[model samples]
Target: MNMNESFQTLNFLPRGKFKVELVPGVSKTNFLSICYGALTTIGLLTFISYSTNYVLLENLAYERSQIGTIVGNLQVIAEIVLLSIFLPIGLIADKIGRRQVYSFGMLTMGLAYFLYPLATGIAELTVYRVIYAIGMGTATGMLGTVTADYPQNHTRGKMIAVTGILNATGVIIVSLFFARLPKTFADMGFDQITAGKYSMWIVAATCVITAVVVALGLQKGTPTEEQKKIPYLKQIKAGLAEGRKPRIQLVYASAFVARADLVIIGTFLVLWGTMAGKDMGMTTAEAQSAARIVFVTSSMSALVASPIIGYLIDKVDRIKAVSFCMAIAAAGYLSMFFINDVLSPDVKPLFVLLGVGHQCAFFAATTLLGQEAPKMKRGAIVGVFNLAGAAGILISTGIGGKIYDVIGPYAPFVLIGFCNIAVSLFAIYVSKTSPDVKEA
Candidate 1:
């Protein structure tokens, strides 16, 4: 069968069908460079993320604390909005040209981050973030499509996994080094808050420069008939069905659940730590510093694990990897419930477990999602996966926060621990059987 017809069989979204400009054995250096650029954006995000709820701390709480909730809400709300928006963006990339979409996304990141210093409250911050989310949705959908544009899957996974390591690199950079930039500026008599803002401005500048390099250096591919043969709307019906396979669905579900666990940590675990220990002798910053240690350590481990996981994903059973990851994470989370000395100087080991457990799940989930999603409908598949994961964040935030408020600070950790264990079992049971879909 021809490439067009094979794509027709994989029908993703009615409008999402775009032709692959990738001639078999095409050079991947361009794609690799672009992925590296995207990783820089990830690093930029890691740095600004610490500022997301900065105002909510007891210290920053008085600095217009109400805006904290609003800023936090922007991320959740944007995730939902992106669900609807990126579906078409993916299809558009398929139809118009992916280079257009990719460049636009970087520009959005540049612009969004540039505006960070000016945002003073929920309303202004929300506007800037929504733009960032739109950029994110575009990048999320396009990266897999761009990778598949290559002829090989293994090579594709390797390149993509490199980006994952870059993500870990970004996290470690901001957590370990960005935290200290403030003091450097303070030595020159700058206010701590002003110095922090300068750090964000630097991240913004990096994104802007990356966007420029991509816009100028990257070549654009012509649109193809892979999607032109089908109407955009009717295509989703065919796409989801064509794309659906039993084992893939189970794997897909594993990503959905695993990412949900991750989103929970990204959204609320740090907040939970500070709130939980107000009377236990640790200040919010101290709790955050301790948690940052976990993130830094895990980010370091991811540097090593990413390529290996990428290698194993295609060769070994993807589900088995997912199951093993969930089991370890479950053990780590459960350990929190039983350990009494969470704040002891010796509690540092738990951070390593938290890091390893979470990073393993992250590496596995992204590898699986990209591997399993059909080229034609990657946008919708990613959208659905993201939708489910976003809901995970929403629920974790709402439920975890409420539990902490009603039960005590320690309640959320206990909840997370039990959840990791339970979800691991569910994922394993699902993976035991084969997915009904055959490999394309």
Candidate 2:
């Protein structure tokens, strides 16, 4: 099918469909990249639902106030582990093919999911989560690199938009199935814990299959421009130096906001919605289904928003694009402040706004990072991007959890709103002062 025809069939918004230069020739690599994007999102969404649900279950099993403490510690532990290994994973991927690292990361992630339901206490869960973070951290870095690697400059935006659509679709599908799976199973005969475990095992099995597919389907490519002639420390020093560029700094900052955007919604929104539902006298299963609907709404918005945002990234000044998106995100989060009820009908528009903002910022940030980073050092640079993201998730979850318990259920969203505004201002400053880097 022609590009225009495909866009027509997808029925994108009138403003979204645009004339573009298309790349010729399709290959296994392109298909593998799409599959990897979709699979990654599925894995991520399932894990997120599992973690948040586990936190809610723990609150009931233990003390409610510990909600903040447990979730905070889990995130802090996982981020710390990710921070430690991310650079090393990138360095290793640079040495070997990205396919090997990608496959290994997927395997490790599957093992971690397999172990999640076996945890008897917070300590055990923490241990498994740290293990899970390694896989997550590695896969996250390579996904960006691989996506950057696959498409020509003219087609890169379209490729990214397609990946984003697939990812949002994956999240929607997983959330639809597994978000209520425990409750669905409970209705049949299984206990809550058993049902949760069954759902988790399904994710684990899928992760293993994804890993095998990646190993078999992806072709080997030389990732680095040259073999490292420098010592490890010097290469590390060089990668660190690259982060100091003005545009690169902005991308790093965007990483902070983008990751925080994701972690907040995934961690807090589910908790808030579920807790509110439970307070409304809903059963655990019913509460979870209700809570998960928020993500469904958000993902649906992102699925539609992706192509438009991707097109803009290719056409506009990237920093300005990022600033605009962040501003929109800030407004979305601000909408939460006036929301008295988590289950209110008014909430969906706010989430839709949030979803669009996050997806746009995600595309803008990663595209800028991919375009600006030195090709030889791209893997390590993307690692730095993921590292900043890890820090954001750590800070957002760790501090936001406390705010949820201490200030109010909605206070975390308010804080995130302010953070978004702050970053948007920074983006504006970068756009004005720095020379624009063309994507090609």
Candidate 3:
């Protein structure tokens, strides 16, 4: 059968109103698989931050004071690895296929997880983290590339919103269930070490299964005739040159702060809550559970707000939408200064705000990038975008971790908050001076 016939056969699939007008050759089946991949890949990646703390305290016997520095260093290492390879990975995806790269990434993550629980020291753990970073950069790079590839220009914001909702859902499920597995096993009469090992093994298995799904479910081969005709190095140069556009510069800036926001919440927020729970005389398992509650609150808020933010993105000038999103993010992250206790019920509202802001900023950045990136050079352009994000992670985690240990846990959030405000102002400037040209 022809591609049209295959798509017609799958027409009964439901993707809601927002998913209308897919680009040619992208069926509802491909869209569904993309959504599921979003759910699992991000869910598993975010859970790593939460679970790493458990391993440090329970399995490695690290002190609370040292944990911040160690986690920071580990993230720095991962980002460094990502910095080196994100562009090449994107070029490879453009040449071979997104599914092959994406599938291999998932399988690599599974390998890292299988080795994670077997670490006897920080050195071993650090090595495993580098392996994990390779998978993360590969999978997430494809995620961004495909997200941009699947939709017509008009439906871009809604597609991003759907994926954003699934991303939040993944985080919630992983935090609530997968993150809690170690504690559950401990409660079931396993030792701390054994529980952590078993939990990681289960996640490792899940990653392998997800790899299989991605390999089979996603659309096969390169995306466009134009891409195939271009020489490889010229594609790289074209992607880099596109950054000269003011709107593209704004998207890159948004990516920097937006990525940092995610890592801060995943790393510092949970660490703060976990430490607070321990101070109250809770066991490591109990403390982790409490931290997960706070983490879940933020993810739940993101889930609720995604469709609304997405709708607004589709309706407004995307640059203006980015400014609005950064404004909300500024408000949320700056609000962290007011919270004296992360574990208190009164702080739930603040966490909710953080969630909404985080989701909005990410959706805004991604949607804007989707709108601006050229179709033929989309993968390479997305790599640069992710490279900017990697730089953000490097700085935020490298410095934020130190300040989190020295100044206060609230310091990291406040630092990124000011960044959000700065980007918001920049977005406003770009909107006035360099508005997007109307698409023909």
Q: How many clashing pairs per prediction, in order?
A: 13, 0, 0
Indicate which candidate wins on lDDT.
Answer: 3
Off by over 4 Å in 2: 1-26, 42-46, 55-60, 224-231, 438-440
- Worst lDDT run of 10 residues, candidate 3, spans 1-10
Report the C-alpha lDDT of model 1 over 1-440, residue by residue, as the tens digit: 12342221211125523112333433344544555665665555554455554433432343332332443455567667666665577667666766677768777776776675566655676787788777766665565455545424444445446566776676677667664454456567876466556756666677667666656544465334565555767655554663456545554555555655554555444444334344466544444555555456546766666666655655566666677776777665555555444445465566567656766676666666656666666655555555555555555545555555556445555666665566566557756666442332
Candidate 2, 1-440: lDDT as tens digits? 23343222222345535433323333544454545655564436445544545544732375656676577677788889988888887777777767788878778888887888788877787788888888877777777777766566655666678777777877777777777777888789987777777777777787787777777766565444474544556667777898887788888888888877777777778878877777898866778788888878887898899878888777877778778888888887777787778788876788898788778777777777767777677777877888888888788878888888898777777787888888789988888889667553
| Pick by TM-score: 2 or 3, better one | 3
Full candidate order by lDDT, most accurate first: 3, 2, 1
By summed lDDT, the worst window of 10 consecutive residues in model 2 runs over: 2-11
Better of 2 and 3 by lDDT: 3
RMSD of 2: 3.6
| Deviation of model 1 at 88, angstroms | 2.4
Q: Can you tell me which runs of candidate 3 are displaced by over 4 Å?
A: 1-17, 438-440
Report the CA-based lDDT of candidate 1 relative to the real structure: 0.57
Each candidate's lDDT (Cα)? 0.57, 0.73, 0.88
